[model samples]
Target: MSTERRAPLDRKRVADTALKLLNEVGLEGLTLRAIAKELDVKAPALYWHFKDKQALLDEMATEMYRRMVASAALDPADSWQERMLKANRGLRAALLSYRDGARVYSGSRFTGTDHAREMESNLRLFTASGFTLAQTVRANSTAYSYTIGFVIEEQGVKPLPGERREGYDVQERARLLAEFPLAAAAGAEIFEDYDRHFEEGLALIVAGVESWTRLG
Candidate 1:
């Protein structure tokens, strides 16, 4: 935490600190003031880089994904379905790393160079698998949405800062059990199986994409 002649508040550093703050605080608890304090800079300093809280949040979401761009890999030879599914798993893990990180990240469209790599990789995979440019882009979007949606669901288990879990609506179970007998009997035991659920969802998405390859 040296305040020495540091590089000026670039989006990278600002967003980095914001991400750290997010892990420390949470979605609603996150504030520009908190981010400012983390970077040891005044709130006004951040204004030069981000227009407002939403801009700051969006930028942080993109900045945080700098990890996914690094950690995930794409083999050009791999089938499109395989590559896209790999991305989905990588993304879910990355978003789950920070608190409400998914909420901030999901709606953001800022594709910094790193994010672009992810996009290009998915598109390339899809195109290689015999899909058209339009199909490739659509597949990429579908994979992205599914990954983000998975993260949102994962984040639900660990209550965020300043949130009380007392209000979790278990009553919905009765309606769900009316149809899903296994769900009713399992009760909250399902919460213990995030890994299994993740794999199941990933397989479902991949299977759908695989169908495209088979019939395309």
Candidate 2:
């Protein structure tokens, strides 16, 4: 029983509603009925634009990349590490904007033109710095791994579900800290130096790749 009227479906409109649904409900709760309700249309109307939910998601992923924060493309004249790090950080920050945004955005297999252009820029920088196309792709993958891994940690915010969250019991923390001094101390410092740690991880990958330079 398709209740949708005989009107044509615009894929972009469907995509916009899908993104809104993702932001409001997160990926787990996303559904075509929800989007249809939001758009004041029928679920079958959505089918005209997207053959299935997977098609809808693929389109939404591409749209998200285009709508993500605007970072100036990589500087080709910079060193390989410099250009790559800038792109990595920029992409991470863009995806960090929405709730559980990185979780949805990063996992999708997006091969849009915007991503292609960004990679071409990185390859130019790396090739200039003595890497073949294959080497550049390897380094690029490693850089991406560091950034997404870091963002996954940052995005996993497990606070109290409501306004009842005030502060944790310092005495309890202290007792736990006494029992596991090193782990507690490290955990406390994680809050203090997350940014520094992110850079260190990314730099390690970039520097490791640099060691493979063909120079004598």
- Candidate achieving the largest lDDT: 1
lDDT of 2 at 165: 21
lDDT by residue for model 2 (1-216), tens = 988674445877788777777757766778888898888887897887778777777777777777653545445568776777787777676656555566666667663465677666667777777788888888788888778777666656421122112334344555778878776666544543456877888888877887865442
Count the clashes in each prediction: 0, 0
- Cα lDDT of model 1 by residue, 42-73, tens digit: 89988998888889887887777776777756
Model 2 regions lying over 4 Å from their true place: 1-9, 69-71, 111-114, 158-177, 191-193, 214-216
Stretches of model 1 off by over 4 angstroms after superposition:
1-7, 159-183, 186-190, 212-216
Choose the strongest candidate by TM-score.
Answer: 1
Cα TM-score per model: 0.81, 0.78
* Model 1 accuracy (lDDT, Cα): 0.74
- The TM-score measured for candidate 1 stands at 0.81
